[model samples]
Every structure is written in C-alpha cells, then in structure tokens.
Target chain A: MVSHKPVIFVVEPFGGSIRWHNPSLPLIYWDDYAVTRGDGIFESILIRDGHAANLERHAQRFCTSAAALGLPEPILNSWINATQAAIEEFGEGEGKCTWTYSRGRASTGIPTAWVSIQPISDVVLAQREEGVRVMLSERGWSFPSELPAKTLNYAATMATLRLARERGFDDVIFTDPDDGHVLEGATSTVVTVKGDKLRTPYDDTILPGTTQAALFAHAESQGYRCKQKVIDVDYLLAADSVWLVSSTRVAARVRRLGEDKLKAPDNENEIRSLIDAAMTRG
Target chain B: MVSHKPVIFVVEPFGGSIRWHNPSLPLIYWDDYAVTRGDGIFESILIRDGHAANLERHAQRFCTSAAALGLPEPILNSWINATQAAIEEFGEGEGKCTWTYSRGRASTGIPTAWVSIQPISDVVLAQREEGVRVMLSERGWSFPSELPAKTLNYAATMATLRLARERGFDDVIFTDPDDGHVLEGATSTVVTVKGDKLRTPYDDTILPGTTQAALFAHAESQGYRCKQKVIDVDYLLAADSVWLVSSTRVAARVRRLGEDKLKAPDNENEIRSLIDAAMTRG
Candidate 1:
C-alpha cells in the first residue's frame, strides 16, 4: 500500500493559490528561497479541534515579521484557508501548522509560499509534563530592538540549544550580551516568580513570546503583580520559580538553571493551573 | 519538447547517495530541516572551470562552524565528492556548489544533507563590475565569535538589506549593536585600504570572509602591510578604499558608504587585477 505523507500545501511563486503537496513529486524549484537563502518568514500555530489557536494574533505577528523581512505579505485569510486545507488533509487532533513565506525561487526570484500541518512530536509534548532543565550561555547577544521575532534562521538559536543538551541540559538561555543579564531561551521566554510578583524581561531583544504575553495578562488578572522589566541574573537566581514558556512546550518550568538546582514553589500546581488556562485561552 | 531546468541534486537523510532533482517530484521531506526548523548549516563555493575555488579553506570553515553549532562533523571528502557530482551533472562553466548539512528531517530527526549547483545569478555578476552602494544598519547584529558563517537562518541580514534597498542603496552594512561601529556587510566582509596597509576586523563578531583572506594574503605577498584589527566607523570613512568581499561577489568596491559618496582610487583597476588573481588562487 502507498503511504500518504502529511500534506504540505504550497502556493505558486507569485502567491496565486494553494495546492496540496505531492508525495510522488518535487513541489519547489531546485533554487527556491526555501533551499538557497532560507530567506523567509515563518509562523507555527497550534491546531486544536480543526482550528488554529491564537491564529489572528499569529497572523498579525507573521505579517509583522514578513514586513520586517520585506517579503511579500500573504493576505491574512490566505493563511487561515491554507491552514484549513492542511487540517482537512491531516485530519488533525492537536497538530501544528507552519507557514513559510519567501521571495520565491532563488533562480527565478519570484515570490511563493507554503504551509504544512503535522502532529506535534512526542518530545515536544513531553516537555510540558516533565518540565526542562536549562543552562545559561554567556552568549548574551541578541538582535537589536528592531528585526523580526522568528525567521528561517535558527542557526544560533539551535546551536545554543545543542550546546546546552551536550552539557546535559534541555535548553540554553541567552543573557544580555553586554550586561550579563538574562535575555531569553533558545525558543521560549523566561518568566520568573519571586515574592508576590511575576516578572520577565520587557525589552524587545527577544521574540515577544506569544505564550508569555498570554500568561502575563492572566497573571495580572489573578492579581499576582506581574511586571515586564529588566531581569538581572542575580534576581533570576534568587527567584522562587522560573519558567520558560512558548507556544509549543507551553510552559517548561526550569527544573534547574545552570549548575544550581532551582527550588519549585510550594504551590507549583496552582501556578501550572493558571499556565494551562492561559495557554489555551488568552 | 520539454525544456529541463538546472539540476538540483539531493542526498537521502542518511547521506548515502545523491540523485538528480526531478521536476515531477519532491526534493525534501515535509519535515525536512529546510522545511521546518531551518536547522542546518551550509557552505557555498564558487566554481569555475570545474574547480571549486578556496575548497580547502571553505571546508575548514564549515567544520569550524559545524563544530560551533554542535553538529556531527560532515566528512570533508563527502563535500568534495558532492561538489564534483554537482559540477559534473550541471556541467558548470561558472556556478556555485551549495551544500546544506542539516540535522535532517524534523520528524525522525536523522541527519540529512544535499548539494545543488546553479550558475551564479546575474545580480551577483553585475555587482562585480558596477560596484555597490551600501547603507549602514546597526540592526544586523550577530553572535560574538564561534558561530558558523553560512547558517540557514538569514532573517536579520536580509531584513537590513531590504531596508537599505528601500532607501535606494545596493546593500546594507552591519554595525556594532552597542557602539554603532561598522561590522560587516550582509553577505560580505568589510575590507578597507589606508596608506600602505590593508586592514579588516580581527574580532570574532563576523564571519571570516574567504575572499577577504585571499585578498589580504595577496596584498601581503605584494609587499603591502596587512592588519586584522578593530575597524572603527571614523577609520572606515577616512579610508582611501573600502570593499565588500565574499565568495560569489569576490570583491565589490563600496561606491557610497552611507551619505558620503567617496571617490574611487586612480589605480582601481590595479586593485581589481589583484582581486582577480587572489580569488582564483588563494
């Protein structure tokens, strides 16, 4: 029996329409932007119940990123419909839909785009439950206040994560390249809870973590005195609890930060209860 | 009569064999590193007359970058053989061989690699003659030392170039995110000539430009002093000549740096003569 891979819907280089990915064929030109430059912007949205969660926000952020990268921005509805096409083909029960928009083939230099939907991997799902241990890399460098949040370029980010993993940690945290202060996780935002307040770095150095934003709002609603401010390394080390949150992994409490084992809050389940509700809702 | 496009060769995820890209097929998996995470490092070499210029140097740099990214070292011989395969299949007069060493399919997460050879674009060729106008964008920050040069991720680099082009410049130069000192070009290294000496940045903040290295060596052999040291913005502007050097463009003289339109040297052709010899040899 022939096996059908998950559908990878692609738009023509000029962004006319969407078509299903052919398992028996090559969809992109050999010199497509996806191959040559990785010169594109992408967004990954969680698909729950045949619907893209936080899609409107994701759509806006994607457009912002695309605009920042100066790639042609796809109409917001095109993403929804294309993602729908992927979902219809995948028969989704909790999957992810990723969209890549680029200036088409590197040879022809036209503009094209695509979206792919697949079930979230078990390793990713496992992080939500098991939490994660993270080490800090002094590579505090970050893109300036401008530039897109996420682009196809994950080299430095993934490299940092790989270094952490090799050193027996789950992920690596990038601190401020100058001040030695905390900046962000390889793929998530760092949030800390200390005393009666929850705080995260307020600067634009990192991808404004979508999950973190939702959690911040929820925390405020819970009257936990949330603040978006500079998070120094000393304060982070002294925090009662720290979590790295993103769309996928949802929230992975940092079981350990560097060599020091962080202590979990006595009411850890209560905080998690809030995280689950925030991730799904706001 | 069907017209065949340029060939794009792909390797299996396990890096066993190579095959020609079929127009009627998919070259990459739905979950390939190119598609999902862009979790890969790559190297591009200029090929002329069946020769890959600076092959050994590019290979060594790739290994250094791969190691920095904490990836399995791709056997150096594999790259050479693959380049040969791509060259033979493409029958290259003047093209480039691009090898992407990826952590492989995002699903199974096995290591995958591929190579493609295509004629260098006319835009790149054009830059060699007409020179280029560059605008400074301090936003294009990179990691300090020890990251791969040609990572699949290129958001910030491309974005700054876009911004510069929008403002009616050919390319963008990156500057120190903190001090606003010049760093490097989007895809090239900054080399300036002052008095009897050739100087470029010695620091680890930028990629070691292969073409720049060759040119510097050629300069030294010709009895010119060369130095790799910090290049401040003031020094850059005061230099007699400044050029952006890379593998493909080789060396494009900077006609305009920001608002200042600098005059070209009387012996510009002499410099070009030296660049040509340097590119083909060292």
Candidate 2:
C-alpha cells in the first residue's frame, strides 16, 4: 500500500541462502528473544548510491555485540554478502542496511540472523540540513558503560523522543544522572567545536558513535585537534558550536541547546564535508 | 517433532479476533517493532492449578510500563480476556501466560497486541526448590530511575548472564558501577532478610518489581519490618539470608552470594509460603 517497499534479506545457516521476503508473511517465530525479550543486537549502515559505507566497522561491531550478548560467533561474510545482495537489487538509493541477531527462539535455540534494506525517509534527511532543535533532559542513568552494547531496548529512548517531539524538539539530549554531563543523543553522538578543538564524550556509557569518530578522524587529519573527554552540560552550553553526529543523521548542527542559542561554527560546511567523507570510507 | 509443544494465543483489534497459533509456524511480522527493534512491553504470569495468578497486578504493571514507554494506553481488559482464553485451552498445567504490545511495524502504525502460553519445563522449576547460585558483576550504569521504564534494551543483562553462565553460575547479580550497590536481576528482584528486617533495593535505578512488592506486603503483614534501600555488595555478601524473587521462578534462596555461603534462613519454608501466597493473589 506504500511506495518504495522495503527489501528484506534474512541469513540462513551454512547451506541456506538469503532471499527477498514477502511483506505480508510473518518473519519471526512467536518466542524469539528479538521479539519477546528484545534479547538481540543489531547494526544499521547507511547505503548511499548502492554502497553500504563502513560495513566492515559495522561488521566488527556486530561481532563484538554478539560476543557481548554471549551468542555464537557471527558469520560476518554471510551478512555482508546478504546485505550486498539486497543493496544490489535496491540499486542507487538512500536507505539503511540493517542486521540483527535476536538470540532467536527460546524453544530450540532458534537463531535470529537476518538483514533488510529500508529507505531513509525524506523527513529524517531534512534534519541533516535544516539542523535539529535539541533539548537537554535528565536521562537519569544510561545503559552503563561497563556494557558497550545496544540490545533491543529502544523503549526508553523511543519514549524520550516521543516526549521531546510533543514538547516541540526535534530530538532529545541525554545527560549523566549523577553529574548532569552531556552523554549522547538517543540515536546520535554529541560533538562540540571550540576554537580549533573538537571534543566529544569518550565515556563508555554512550555508544562510541562511529560517525562521530569518522568526523573526528577527518578533522584531525585536517589539523583540527580532536579529543575525547567528559563534557558537562555547562561546558556544552558554553561551547562555540555543537553538533550531533551519527550514521543516518551524519552531522546535524544543534540550533539550540536547551534555552541557549548555539552560534554556528565558521567552518560548518567544511566540518560537514569531513564527516561526509568519513561516512563513506571503507 | 517435539513432544508437549507450547500453545500460543494471540489478540487482535477491530476486524481481528483472539486465536490459538500452531507451535511450529511463524507468528510475528518481519516489520513489527517486536521483531525488527524489540520495541514493546510484555508480562508473563504463572498459571498454577488452572489459574493465571495475580493477573490484575500484571495488568497494572503492563499499563504502567506502557505509560512509562509513552505508548498508547493499553486495553487491559482485552489482555486479561485473551489470557483467559489461552489458559482455558492449556487446561491444568504449569505454563506462563505471556502478553506483548509491540509498537508494531514502523509503517501503518499497526498495533501488535498478542498473547501466548508456554509451558515451564521441569528443569527450570527445580531452581525454585534446589536454589540458585548467583555471581555479582558490574552493570556499569543502568537505565536510570528518572525514567523507571524498561525499553527493549536487554543487551547488557543478557551479556552479564552469559558470562556468569560460562563461569558456572545459574544467574548474575548486578552491582552499581559507582558504589557497588545491588541492583535487580535480569528477570527477577532481589530481597534479603537479616534479623527482624526484610530488605530490598529501594532505588529507582532498578525495576519496581511487582512480585517483590507483594513479598514485602506479606512480610509486613507478618509483623516483620520491611524496607527498600541501597544494598551494597558487601552488605549483600554479609546478608543473613538472600533470595532472588520473581513471578516465574517464585522465590529462589541464594545458596551462595559471591564466595560467601549464606546459611539458609531459619525460616526458608516460611519465606516460601509468603512468596507462594503472593504468586496467586489477585
């Protein structure tokens, strides 16, 4: 009933091959932890112009995530092959190439090894240019750093974003519960620029945003000093310019941090190009 | 090919009706949040001697969780009715009545209102009597209390349990990274008794466990002083007697908390009775 239907690719065992999924059919079992308990790990890579950027990094993260969740070693090549197959069929479009390991069904040790390619909507892309309105809300405690993992637990973040939308913000910014330090965005990373310095939170309490890392690496190559450190809310507010970075969002300048207006960096376009360059790097 | 397969029941909205599902067939949509992102809320109630015990409590918790997740208000009656139908089909056997309200597919805003019944195998039930050995591990930071909501993020807890299992422990106990205080278990609650006091972690950092609440109520009725407070690791290790309580496992005494052996509570049978009474209470 909708235009541009999503193309799904599910991974099978050794001899099993991935295929296009029928949208109307049920794809997961009744008891897979991915469904019942959200007991799985996933990755979403941007597929731009038929290329899934940073797939290897994503693959490595997926393996690390699998080990973190105590699952069997992920068949990385199988996933890359399957995702590439889907992307090839989806040729030359902007979409997210996603994969998940849901720990599968509880009954027979069902494995949730699957991948799909879904279009990135125009509305989300608009945030990349128009910039995003952000609000700093108390995120209490986050999913702790001792665990550098993202399980299927998007409920709290979804709820937070929903609340933020209702209150007229594009996205929400999470702060440390104990110290009110800037942690990260629900689906993005926090980066700030002051003079020639580019800084972001290095603590493990947040997802070590790959897109943010790419931008920083590119920035360092360009002679901008880049460092990872804890950023307090006050420090964030007082920064010269702030931006939220991620794979999908790429680099979005924060127009406002709470009630304060953030001055745009003189090198906004230049910084963005660096981030874009890293996003597509192999 | 399986003996004693689980019987599943599903709920539907307008133009939809509740029904039983084949154990071997697919039950979740590929796009449903439950499958794709594990974005949903769920509850599992114990069915003993033909009754879905404490369903009202579970219903209330479900509603609370829905609110916490900022989803639409749940149609609690429909859930109760659906569970009744599943229980009727299963007849007299120990099983869990499970219900989930996944945000559903990202497109169409389709609501995933479903229910299922799965039998509790003998091996799992044995933990209630034989007790469980638990190890303390750092959970870094948890989804903080300001939210008091659980999203589908089960990644860290699953990883911690997996590590503990590899080390031969039945379950893993989480300690706060900052201060090493006891937090809740992956799927259960923590409670202890020392002298005349019944104590459990009162912090909002952990789930407000319903079963644990009932135990406290029953304990208070028996004239024991009940309290909720931060339980440090040392305090838990030194506890007179500790137990991890939940709806399914009921009350499992901590045979060993870390390397310290907790002498059985002089009142093991007494504590069990309290837990049992709460398990079936409406």
Best model per TM-score: 2
Q: Residues B1-282, candidate 1, lDDT per residue (tens digit)?
A: 222245566665345566666533446665666645667778878887778887878888888867776668777666677678777877738786777777766656677677777677778889888899989777545564556456776656666677788899999777776776678888888888877788887666777888888888888898778888887778878988888888877888999988988789887787777777887885
lDDT of 1: 0.74
Alpha-carbon error at B205 in model 1, in Å? 0.8
On DockQ, the candidate that comes out on top is: 2
Q: What is candidate 1's CAPRI-style docking category based on DockQ?
A: medium
TM-score of chain A of each: 0.90, 0.94
Q: How does candidate 2 fare on TM-score?
A: 0.90
> Candidate 1 DockQ score?
0.50
- TM-scores of all models? 0.89, 0.90
Chain B TM-scores per candidate, in order, are 0.91, 0.93
Superposition error at B237 for model 1 (Å): 4.4
Write the residue-wise lDDT of candidate 2 on B1-282 in tens digits.
223457776777433477778868888877787766657888878888778877777788888877776667877667777788887877777787777787877776867877877777665688889888888887775674545554556766777787788888888788777777788777899988887688998666777787888778777877889999878877787777788888778888889766777778778888788788877664
